[model samples]
Target: MSTPYEVEHGVTAGQTGRRPQNRRVDMESFFSFLHQISTDAISSVSSETTPQTHNNRHAEATPVDTANLFRLLQDQFATLRQTSPDATNRDFLEALIQEVDRDIADLPRLHGVGQEFLDGLDRVSKKEILKGKKGEEKCPICAVKFNEDPHPLVVALPCHTSHCFDLECVAPWLQSKGTCPMCRKNFVRKKEEKKELKEDSEEEEEFDNMNGVWLATGYPQTVIAIRGVDEKGLALVRNGVEVL
Candidate 1:
């Protein structure tokens, strides 16, 4: 027998709790179908001819100022997220931030995004464009092979060289003087310092039970639209409040 509740909701009593996702939903196919529908709708709307038909379509459809509405929402979300860590324990904010970063960078390849994606990231965060280093690139301070990870008290530098110092080994030393011990190529000390300081600050700012959070500003429009994205990022924030 069909219940009044089930009937109102367009479902039969027998179908209750029988969600496809719970049982045998092919998520990939579902997503593909959704994508197909979206692309089709977009094409239909865009290809519509004549101002009259366009106007009629606009009148018939629900009105939504997508751009402005998105901007407003994003601004609100960014502020709330930025303050989450400071106001609360921080677990909420850190996850949100990472999610935002990842989402911003990733776009459906169907969209045909070019190198423009790389252009959106902050230069300080981008991978150092690797350049070829010269002969037997021996770390001046440590004198070790160039291809492996640095050992304790050994600091790795550009040019595939290792100096016997950790980030702390040469952070201050490099901060004051921006040159690698082995190679004179300018080392990015300020950026590294800021990163280290931020991590430390995040750790100290909240208890262990909470996630570390840091507020960042100056995200690009693309970043806001896609979500928080940078080199290392996630899809979305957890609970609509935190990123992880």
Candidate 2:
């Protein structure tokens, strides 16, 4: 019988669990551990789906195994919750566990934002967040006071000026829902709309480059709907006969 951590990662739990309780976890090491966990989960998913990838190599590879990745994240958070001495840390971890659990449950309906959108979100500085605020402002998702952390990474959503959130708390939600959790404003649709507009503009530019100059310079420029199209692909009638 293997422990959950051992089952998740082939390595024995003792090797990874050597961190002393009293030692402070550096930001880099903390995130690195999360990165490793997410990587292992993705590898596990890749192994399971190897046959599918082998069958259709042309298909785009999934970046992350959302279900497995969230599950692993939940497990880690739960473990941390168990061991955390501070009530605040425990509470935060518990909230994180629930968030991951909800993501796992809602896997079928989730259409999350890609890394590009997450990276492009407007960073809200502490000075900006504190400006003109008399009382403590809480993050909409975690409901934790913004000032609780000496330095909180806050982000502003495109939906509205007031729609701000703690980057740490809202990141997973955005990745899962691709919407403003407080206002339910859809970011995924906005991204798609922007993409469609860009493509349309590109196509229009290509068409204009190929035909616009020639038509403007060569023909009399009488634009009309015609059954016959000219060699230059223009629908122009010249002297009672459609130019072919």
Say which candidate scores most in lDDT. Answer: 2
Please list the residue runs of candidate 2 whose C-alpha ends up more than 4 Å from where it truly belongs after superposition: 1-64, 70-110, 211-244
- Runs with alpha carbons beyond 4 Å of true place in candidate 1: 1-153, 162-164, 188-244
TM-score of each: 0.17, 0.50
Which digits, one per residue and each the tens of the lDDT, describe model 2 over residues 1-244? 2222233345443444422433212122222333343321111122232211133334331334456545544654555465675676677667666756766676534466654676688877767656636117666444555655444466789998788776655655565557786677889998889999999999897665553233333446654334433467666554456665
The total number of steric clashes, by the backbone 3 Å criterion, in model 1 comes to 12
lDDT of 1 by residue, 29-50 (tens): 2222222322212111111222
- Per-residue error for 96 in candidate 2, Å, reads 11
TM-score of 1: 0.17
lDDT of each: 0.31, 0.53
